[model samples]
Target: MTANKGLVATAGTELDRLAELYGGALTYEAAVAGGIPIIRTINEGLAPDRIRRVSGILNGTSNYILTAIDQEGLSFDAALKEAQAKGFAEANPIKDVIGIDAAYKLIILTKLIFHRTLSLAQLAPTGIDHLSPRLFAAAKEWGLKIKLLASTWESRGQLNYQVAPVALNPSHPLYQVDGVTNAVVIDSDLVGTSTYLGPGAGGKATANSVLADLASLSRGEQLTGSSACLRIENGRPLTKQRYLVVNPTGLPTGLQFSDRHATSALTPALTPTDLQRLRATNPGLETLALGE
Candidate 1:
């Protein structure tokens, strides 16, 4: 059976069942970013030791809404409604906007990459619902954009995973992705960093992707094998260097200024730990920070 479905676990399970019941091969390819053709290249013989990072923008609805809000100055609600009216969003948008959709996709990608199955229940899922208009304004002030990023990778021997919104600088490739496009950057030891970008939503496009996969299967083409196996090492903790804007009148003493963005104002580089401490002290005022 050939089916072009989205990143819904039900679809995956059903396909597996059908493949088992009929004793025939079940193939899928059109389920990811709209029309992009991504074959599930899983080679059991390949080692996982060579992998580095798996990062990508996995949802089209959130990506579109973010781009509209940032570039067009549309309110989040307005953008969301527009997406719904245009059929870019599901009637029940919670799954798409809240990272459930991305979580499922990540699970599939991880299994294919590592030749090990994983469950969506094991992932740490965070959505973009917490983002505020003020945050968007702050991002604009710093010439950055916010995107919902879902990633899972194995390094050293530990697995790291997250689905959340991140503020990306203009220099990042994700910044260039706008509207309903989806892009993924795979960083590996052999392949420094390879990026794939294309339409990430829409039914017709998704159908095309699935059909392309079926065509390949018909031609007897095989999916690429997994990477070479390696020892999993503990990944280093991430420390962000950020721009913090705080009103000097309210801030406590002992906070050293990293640099001044303007004559009267200062932009201090603060770590997440430092920001947490500052917020704990003063929770009533506004603070701005930038990180890459």
Candidate 2:
């Protein structure tokens, strides 16, 4: 449904159907409507104010591809083939590879966690299809595992979300996650961080979770959800962005290097606004982040 434009109608109808039987719907679709006490609400005796952030690696295809490329030293094409061979990827794999698939899951997630609705066009998702296998291979050498992350957080009562490849160091819980496995990290103000790790086996996992929700709903669990007057952003300036501008020789004035780039990596640092400013300031600076 997310691949098409009728998701809002589909989710609404499913949620209303669930509402007929369960006081609040508990399926993932219902959870997308913010009616269920799923992870967003089911904190273990912890209140809402105590929770700070929710981030997850939600796409199994992307995870599997990256795992093959990084751990198994397969090229992007080979890794993608492997993912398809293992039944982790679709025959037409653009949605999985381009991050649209992850964005839909994130859209469902942002609605559940923040009580706000968002569409694909607004998020303008960034894809990993532009990512260089060389960049990931280098990251692996440095003990950094890259994962496509669906992250959402609240600041000043406004909630924001994004899906992007994140370079995780050893200390990050997501660093150890690989293959088609998925993991979600809920960072709170009190209990610190709780991580949920699972197989993320596409429709199989969805069916399993749906069954679990039915079992929970059978118990007549009741939870109240809140809808607030909140706004959404494509999100912040992304705390960290790794880049390897192909043709730039000397440093751009006032630009401090974030990390030592390998001589051949092709990642770029130009956010749209930054690219505009750079061109206005230094034209012929031939580099841009893949999405932009």
Task: Tell me how candidate 2 scores on lDDT.
Answer: 0.62
Residue-level lDDT of model 1, residues 136-227, one tens digit each, is: 77667667788888776765555666677777877776778887888877766755666778888766877776777777668765454365
Model 2, 1-292: lDDT tens digits are 1222136422744654567676565344222212222343433244454455678887778888888888788888999998888888889999878888778777765665566677777767777788775556556655667788877777766777777887776788887888887777777666788887776655655555556556656876543333344677557544434443432354444355554453323334645566556556653343322221
Q: What local lDDT does model 2 show for residue 32? A: 29
Indicate the residue-level lDDT of 275 in model 2.
51
Candidate 1 TM-score over all chains jointly: 0.77
Cα error of candidate 2 at position 233, Å = 2.9
Considering summed lDDT, which 10 consecutive residues are worst modelled in model 2?
A: 29-38
Q: What are the Cα lDDT values of the candidates?
A: 0.64, 0.62
